[model samples]
Target: MTSFEFPGQYYELMRRDFRNLAAETDFLASLLPDGGRALDLGCGTGTNLRELGARGYCGVGVDQSASFVEYARRMGGEGVEYVHERVEDFESEDRFDLVYCLFMTLNYLPRAELRRVLRKMRGLLLPGGHVVLEFGHLLNFVESYQPYTVAHHRGDGVLVTRLARQSLNPRAANWRNEETLLVREADGRVSMYDNFFDQAVLTGPEVRELLADAGLHVSAEYGGFRKEQVPPHGRGPVVIVATAEGAGAL
Candidate 1:
């Protein structure tokens, strides 16, 4: 399976999407403990880390992309540290009060890799720490659909845009697929990558089992961070908040 990395343009798009930024900030704020230390896993460009730091929390971000990490470090303040490393290989001498994996970043890994990463996340949390995870709902892709396309106008000419059809390996334990497309214009050309995570459909039960195996308990699962329960055949994303079973007492 191919790994997903947001291009610089996409990262900037996320930074400008006020609605999404507000929703995410609200969700993270709700999950934070008083003056807590927070970890942003797969933190692209460190946008969330900067927000957390602005809110007076000690925030650290980790990502495999060196350019992204450098950009994040330059953009984020001193309170927010950006680390260049894969989530599975990230090690810390101290535990955090909260760990977050957002934007379906976990879906990039296969089942075993995901499990191992989750174990690492568990190990990086303090006793009362919580993990807030978000991923796309797989049920949305049960049926095939035409690709969505968009084009932008350049000063001299029009940009060309196309989205190609993609499919998930239904038989695999980690059922997921990606849609890759080309973005071409007079200035430059680039590939845009978007992945559909059907892991919720193929591994929801297994995810719960694995969390339990890791000594974590599911506190809640929402259709989105807005706090709505996921419905049967829900086409929205899934946001999960989990914690160590007895961590609340710590």
Candidate 2:
């Protein structure tokens, strides 16, 4: 296996292959206030922040990965900033109109940590500000399970291929994912990187309860990127849109 000091350096390369950032941002934009501050918890590579900035929103992206933060900073943009810090320890005097944690970032945290992070997010937001969370549902894992899958992308004379695998541990109530990346550079050099992640398996009701405990009231829920409501045990992404208690509809 080829080694990389910071595998996250190539994160952007494979991100688009798996997600439609443009569409995702479009949906998020609709939920955001007009031209106010925003915070991206667990922002990976700052792609979403850059998109938000383009839409005239000043934003801050916080992540624990130094490599990802460095990459995001180098791809700088007006009204966008990147911070290197874990979500649990991140602090800011600025109150945001929108605070979002996307792509199942919170799922990686244990229940206790996730609760703390949710509370922290709530505290960082202005009254009536929104908090959007994307979670990986247990049904999604079960329905989408496969031995392995491959994704390939080429851009700017660089090519990347990723192999992904997932498994569910019912007893542990956690889902595990493994990914391997094969990269080919313009210089004809080849390298490989591997990564693994474990996410807690949570149902919609459980997520709602957690949000309630954190003083956030759920206003909307979706199974995926679409705005439509999903079944309680939906077999796809579990997206929760909420605002602090007593903060009425937007």
Candidate 3:
């Protein structure tokens, strides 16, 4: 599996990262005690970690993109530190009260790599700590396939275009896809890039089994950031709430 994790591209992403930073922080805070320590895996630009710092939570974030790490470091407040490294290779004796990997980040990894990343997360988790992962919504599997494409012309006269196709790879039991993006500047400079990758798919009971194999157990599962219970008939991403397999307490 491959990803467009190039740090330079993060600048374009930062301008439009629409995640509700406040609500995400509040949800995380609700899961832990006061002054808790947290770790964010695949943490992009460390914006989330910065928010945790504001809430009196000390946070450690790791991402493979140096641009993201630097961006986070520059924008950070007290009690937030970032490391630029692959999530699976991150070695820290320090454990966290809350450890989370969200935003379909794991979807970028193949199955073997996903297991390694999960094991690393398990090891970094403090006893009784919880882990959150964004499993692509059940709707992804249920909904009919459709071509995905988007174009945004920023006020700054920068046009960003994205086009993509997705399909299942039955032999690998994963999603095989390709995407192309173009950046056009008003100054007449244009850059184009394309990417092909495969992402592991976790569906239904099979997902629970994968987590169990990683020494984690599902504590709860939601439809999205709203914490809505996942219904069988629903069509949305699966945000799973998990904890160390054999540990007790929150």
Best by lDDT: 2
Worst 10 residues of 3 by lDDT: 6-15
Residues 160-211 of candidate 1: C-alpha lDDT, one tens digit per residue: 2424444445566344444443545455755555533334333466667777
Q: Please write out the lDDT profile of model 3 over residues 94-134, one tens digit for every residue.
A: 98989888766777656677767777788888778898887
The residue ranges of model 1 lying beyond 4 angstroms of the native Cα positions read 1-7, 14-19, 143-164, 173-202, 247-250
lDDT of 2: 0.81
Flag regions of model 3 displaced more than 4 Å. 6-18, 141-144, 153-159, 184-191, 195-197, 246-250
Q: By the lDDT metric, which is better: model 1 or model 2? A: 2
Question: Which has the better TM-score: candidate 1, or candidate 3?
Answer: 3
Best by TM-score: 2
User: Taking the tens digit of each residue's C-alpha lDDT, what string does model 2 give over 89-206?
Assistant: 8989999988998887887776568778888888999877899999877677778788688888887788888788877787888777788888999899999877777778777778
Q: Which wins on TM-score, candidate 2 or candidate 3?
A: 2
TM-scores of all candidate predictions against the true structure: 0.78, 0.89, 0.82
Which pairs of residues collide in candidate 3? Answer: 137-236, 137-237
Residue-pair clashes per candidate:
1, 0, 2
Stronger candidate by lDDT (1 vs 3): 3
